[model samples]
Target: MNTNDSKLREQIAYFGRSMFERGLTAGSSGNISVRLDDGWLMTPTNCCLGNLDPADISRLTRSGVLVSGKAPSKEFFLHEAFLDRRPTDRAVVHLHSTYATAVSCLPDVDPRNVLPPLTPYSIMRFGKVALTPYHRPGDKRLGDEISIVAAEHRAVLLANHGPIVAAKDLESAVYAAEELEETAKLFLLLQGQRPRLLTPEQVAELERVFGEKEDDRAKTCC
Candidate 1:
């Protein structure tokens, strides 16, 4: 009911609508959450992103208690585990984007190189996307696996699932997730044909530039 909470509520609803409209998620499949000074603002469990009401969002305490009405998403562990791993994170977005999930199901896709350096924007946004193996939806083990690589990755592909990204704010988080899906699309488009990859020197340089800033940021996890 306060000013900041109201603002965040609107922001969540706005992004949730964008995700659905943009086809990043379908049905009731995706969940979103952003960190608040008090706790977090998460989409209500089973609520389709396209139809979410700002006031219907769930508010969870730092200790993972549900402080408001409506149950939290069943995959709450995915969000909470990232927060535990990285205190600097401000938001988390998980989407079952078409391209990203398709790439995930491919056995040839490499975890270390989940997304190629197809565009500088992708590189600048998400340095390297770690690919985590498949786990059933809402499985706590998914969070555990993500925690292991969260320290080094800004984005990750959930094998047979989709992609999850964490960032300093909701906008950036959503943007990164979008880029992940785009890169995956490009990867599949270029499959069966060798595509031009960024040279090691270029990748190294990007890492050097972005890596410094990322490294200084409280030793964050994904």
Candidate 2:
């Protein structure tokens, strides 16, 4: 591998292990991908994130041909949808994290924005998390749904599935996904009580100060 690819491989493995150890995902139920100049690097299908080998990461050409390492995750198209819709996003993380998936399975959550504005960090990192209706795992139609929502959202909840998040780099993506999980956990914990939420004015201010430029980029990319 070239120097950059070698470095990215190790990075993926390192973060994958962190996610597993922290219980963000378990039992091979998640995938991570990084967009590269030539193509992309992704976690192998059905491999435990806790024990990934840097050399076993999957490499795909820009045209989506697998050129090295293990088979790519079946959810590659889901990751592609985000990258395609957000040119600035260089990495994607999809995880069946516990609290986030619990939120996805809940009925009556706002489909357009599943996550409530419970924290400023969530708003700053995610803007709003669209919720896509359920599709069987590996369904191509899931990608179609994700592309439509991802055009306006950097993070989304897959109904009865989990959360998928994209960002400018792997670290940002990982942090955003972690934030999503934590916000979900908070939402569940405070379900019965009327917890204070960020007001619309506050949300708008955050969007204006932090999200406006990215929204413009998203529009241009779409």
Candidate 3:
């Protein structure tokens, strides 16, 4: 394999282990993908993120054709939809984060503002976390729902499912995904405690100064 493909494979393996170790995902429950110099590299269907083999990663053409390796994850439509809707997206990570999924189960959670402005890290890494409605795993309906919110959100929590995060690269995508879980964990900790949340003005200012450049964070590049 070419050096580029090898490196991308290593990245998938590395991030896969990190995600699995961090409890962001369990079993074979998460998927990841990154834009490549030629097209893209994605984790194979049913592959455990913690044990992915570089030679086993699914390769897709820029036009979405399956070029080599095993079949791509059935939920690939979700990734493709993000890239199609957001020209700047370079990587996609979908995970069944515990706290985020728990919050999604709340009947009153606002889809447009899933996470409160609890910390500057959340504001800078994720402008707004959209709460997408429930869809069966591998269902394309979820992709459609994400399309509607992609215009404004870099990360979204799938109701009764998980969170989907996008970034300029694999590391960034994973970082944002972790940030989502951590912030969600914080939200749960403050539940009913009415912990003071960042005001609209503060959130706005943080977004203005740090949001635009968040993709440049050391961990996020493709």
Query: For model 1, how does the per-residue alpha-carbon lDDT over 1-222 read when each residue is reduced to its tens digit?
Result: 788988988998899999899899999988899988888889988899998888889888876688885788888889888767778878999999999999889887678777778766677677788899888987889999999889888788899998889988888788788878888889889988988888878888877776667533333323
TM-score of each: 0.92, 0.94, 0.94
The lDDT for every candidate, in the order shown, is 0.84, 0.91, 0.85
Predicted candidate 2 versus true structure: per-residue lDDT over 109-168, tens digit per residue:
898988789987888777788999899999999999998888789999999999999998
Against the correct fold, how does model 2 do in TM-score?
Answer: 0.94
- The top-ranked prediction according to lDDT is 2
- Model 1 lDDT at residue 196: 86
On lDDT, the stronger of 1 and 3 is 3
lDDT of 1 at 133: 85
The regions of model 1 sitting more than 4 angstroms off are 211-222
Give candidate 1's TM-score.
0.92
